[model samples]
Target: MVHENKHVKNARYVRTVESMFACPVCRASMKVVHYQSLICSNHHTFDFAKRGYINFMNQPVNTKYSKGLFEARRKLMTEEAFFEPLSHAIASAIHAHVAKPKKTSSILDMGCGEGTLLSTICNKVSSRGIRDVIGAGSDISKAGIAMASKNYSDKVWTVADIANPPFKESQFDVILSILSPSNYAECNRLLRTGGIVVKVVPRSGYLKEIREVLFHKATKKYSNEATLERFSKHFQVAEHFRLCYTTRLNPASMKWLVQMTPLTWSLTEEKEMSLAEEISNQITVDLDVMIGISPK
Candidate 1:
């Protein structure tokens, strides 16, 4: 048997969902040409990387998230099962809300870091009987997308900006924003009329152990009131679920916990080392999973 490289496999998969994409430059429909490049109707083109992900941004945009951060995050999510309950909850929300007359669905994860949440949710949804599901993940961080493509080759991975996503309007049945920033308007444009958006936001107690070590008393407490208000402004919230749990981590997982979040970004090398050592073995995972239907 001839072996196909990652690029070949990804290009073939993109061909199946080619209509879901719009040229980032021309906003025209795109099709995979010669199993290598995605060419638009107006002749604009984007090539797939050898690692099986597409870079949709015309210019490079640097972010604070690095390869090491995403790697550490992947370890915590995959090895430590840090967000297992949250992933299952999101899958349940999708199964409950999304219509299944055709028995098929398309899901897009905006600001998907390392693609673990999206990939896990996809599997859970499929296990729930939605076998014909298409999963796509996008993040501004090229490093995150690269890691995602390498690990989850079955799904489409793209380095894209959430604020201005490069996709056709009303092409997705569900849009997910997991502990990441969201652009409600872009989500509205991306979802079908009756489609849903599942957004996960951190509550006050989320990562409280780490927060206590990294911040002053005033800055340690976190709130999602403003975020909920903004989400409600754009969509009619169908369901609101709060998930809270505690999980114990080993020393290596604790190290990953410190590196996986932006909360520790402000700490110096010495302070970071001290803070990592200070964090306890138990960590809290408190979150709000909101399912909203676009008013459009």
Candidate 2:
């Protein structure tokens, strides 16, 4: 048996969902041309990289996230199964809210760093018997999207700005924002009627152990009240679920956790090591999942 290259595999998958895309430059409809590039009516074409991901940005953008950070995140997510429960909850919400199981359901993961959560949730949804699911992920970080395309070939990955997503309006059945920044306006425009948005935000107790060690007393407490309020303003809140658990990680996993999160970005190498050592083993994960319906 012969194995297809990433370019061939990604092109085949993109053809199925070509109509979902809009030109990032002209906002015109786009179609896959010659199984190599996506060309719009205005002839603005975006080529797929050899590694199987399309870059939709007109100009390159710099982000703080690096290749090493995404790699660490993937290790923790896949090897440690640190986010298995949260992934399960998001998949369950999608399964419950998606109206027609027989029809092909389109899902977009915005701010999908490394694409692990998107791939995991899509797999879970498929396992629940919803086989006809189309999954796509986009992030501003080229590093993240590159890792995602290399690791998860089944889904379409793009390096795109979430604020100005390169997709047609009302194209998606479900939009997922998992512990990442969100663009509610774009989400409102991208979701089809009867579609749902799953937005996950961290609660005050989320990673409190690390916060206590790294932050001052005044800055240690975190809250999502503002985020929840903003989400409710854009869509009707349908269901809210809180997921909390404590996971004990080995020293290596703890090191990855510190490297993966932005909370440690400001810390010096010495401080990061100190914080990691102080946290020891047990860490708390507290999050709230919000299922929202776009208002008419």
For residues 52-122, what per-residue lDDT tens digits would candidate 2 score against the true structure?
A: 89999888998889898999999999999999999999888888887774557889999999999999999
Q: What is the TM-score of each candidate against the true structure?
A: 0.96, 0.94
User: How high a TM-score does candidate 2 get?
Assistant: 0.94
What is every candidate's alpha-carbon RMSD to the true fold?
Answer: 1.5, 1.7
Q: Which ranges of candidate 2 are over 4 A from the true structure? A: 1-3, 216-222
- Candidates' C-alpha lDDT: 0.89, 0.89
Each model's number of backbone clashes? Answer: 0, 0
lDDT of 1 by residue, 22-102 (tens): 988878999999999889999998899999898988799989898989999999988999999998898898888887764
Q: How many backbone clashes does candidate 2 have?
A: 0
